[model samples]
Target: MVKWDEDIYNTPAYPVTDAARYLGIPVVTLRSWLKSRPSADNNDQPALEPLIQRPDPNLPQLSFTNLVEAHVLRIIRATHGVKLDKVRKALDYMSQQFDTAHPLVMKRFQTDGVDLFVDQMDRLVNVSRSGQLAMRETLKHLLTRVEWDEEGIATRFFPLIESVPESEKVIFLDPAIRFGKPVIAGTGIPTASIVSLIDAGDEIEDVADEFDCTPAQVRAAIQFEAQNRAA
Candidate 1:
């Protein structure tokens, strides 16, 4: 059996659709990011390199690291309205300077790399001074959802239960746990399982009792499932 620490996080585990659903982005957007394609106006130019690479070129799957990288990209693109092309240029520069294929997942990115990325973006695009500040703040906020290990690698991802100021870390995805499915933070209980019980007509209090979790946790799981379904 493969040891839990032996490339478990990097193993191709999530389907492209699942990754997009988890990250709350459209499937087409995720596919565009993973597959190289010609520029819209200049089809003659060489295709841009994919932002995240699939473990197998033929398989439409993503590892945990890919999910994290895409999540960061989603935040950068959605929050500040920066185009993927500009984000790609900034990421390419960072990848060369940081000497890592996955620069966004590096813990150093939370500290040292954000400024470099912001400065690079300023040079690559016409972002205002205040917009640069907003970009930094947004990156800082995005980093809060990621938990890093001692080796400075991302270990756990807390997906938003709701896209609101009061969103809590009630649900998380750890590749080492349950094949990277979303689970309640302190328990191994899958959020989908909890939501399933709720869908089967179990009351929130009863489902919490059944799972040995809080009613609030069950509610959060339900809300997460609802959001994913709507997405």
Candidate 2:
């Protein structure tokens, strides 16, 4: 059972359970984590703590934008392909919208993190070819600082656009999600490999039969590959 602050109605309210669901934190564990924070007095010097240490009983009452930001942060910490630039912009945007006590810094990456981010975003979004390359490069310019791990991989940020609703299409422009592989809409199977078998003189019926997919699915793969090549 949980209660929310009605004073912040414009902000969506979540039960402790919903917060746990959206943030992927277990309810009991999240409560314990929140309780572990050092109590902050308004008169204190810094006046605030790092995110993991912030104290707020009604954290579930966050503004809609901040809720998304916090959710995004939690997601990024799990998903490795999201870029810091997008995360920075997203965090700052949410802070402005929700009046967060701490705002994220917009930093650029020194390594291949931005490229990876661009690649991932492009794969999820169906941007036109003329703008695809430019958009990828523009994403890189948005950050001023970045950090990577011992493996040189940028710390992955979460809630991939791929997981979002509109990006569910199986178009040619999206090939980064499944190993530089283009998968069918809503399926993990690759489009290119499927179409390749058909193009190499394999009967559409035979290929479909071998793959355990409908003939319509095989045709879709062929069409998708053809359109992409034409583009």
Candidate 3:
């Protein structure tokens, strides 16, 4: 069974809406992945397996580890056209092998799990040689956004904003600051706070000036909120 941690410091508590924004994934999509909502007509249908087990089975929001799984899955699905069921199977394989509920956050994923994951996907998707290399690199990029303890367990996530790739990020979700809300990398200003000013009809440059951030950052905040809400 997956471990559950309710202590705020030990697990991410980003609401479903905000977690979706930081991950650049739709809220409904994330919800569907985290929990199986049975259709009104299909009581006998087999339950769909979730990709990653959340730290809390009761809460609707995602934890930091859950966000990491979403991040890597997004890249694989988008770039390689892999299906979610296949990804779920690969995760199951890793979980059983690694003896951990959250394999993506562990050091094992980057080492042996990456090859095993790619191999499973290749069987289902027939990824090319270059595609396999790309998959490995994607895994590496996912690792970069996480902060690990000396024991090598992932504890904190510096969420790369949807508008920014991990390689070119200017925003992050630090749990200690602003309650783990997405913010300008060094500044504690919430992206949503800046975006609110723009939504209220303030110009981007003016919002930037008000927040002591660049016009581009204002734009990023605006884009993050816009896309997230739309999801």
Q: How do all models score by TM-score?
A: 0.92, 0.28, 0.75
Q: Report lDDT (CA) for all predictions.
A: 0.86, 0.43, 0.73
In candidate 2, list every pair of residues with a backbone clash.
75-158, 76-157, 76-158, 80-156, 107-144, 107-145, 108-143, 108-144, 108-145
- Cα RMSD of all models vs. native, in order, equals 2.6, 16.4, 4.6
What does candidate 2's lDDT look like per residue over 1-231, in tens digits?
222222231233444454454345455644442333343434454423224323244454433223333443443433433444444444444446435433321122222434544444555543457555564444443221122235332222222122224222332212134532345544556777788787788998998777777676677677655644543
lDDT of model 2, residue 224: 54
Number of the top candidate by lDDT? 1
Residues 1-231 of candidate 1: C-alpha lDDT, one tens digit per residue: 554234767788999888888889999889888988577668888888788877667777898988899989998988988887788888989999998788898899999899999999999897899998999998988788998888888888988767434346888899889989999989889999998888799999999999999988888888888888887
Clashes of 1: 0
Give, for candidate 2, the lowest lDDT window spanning 10 residues.
Answer: 153-162
Please identify which of the two predictions, 2 or 3, would achieve the higher lDDT against the true structure. 3
Kindly indicate the candidate among 1 and 2 with the higher lDDT.
1
Q: Rank candidates by TM-score, best first.
A: 1, 3, 2
Tell me model 3's lDDT, rounded to 2 decimals.
0.73
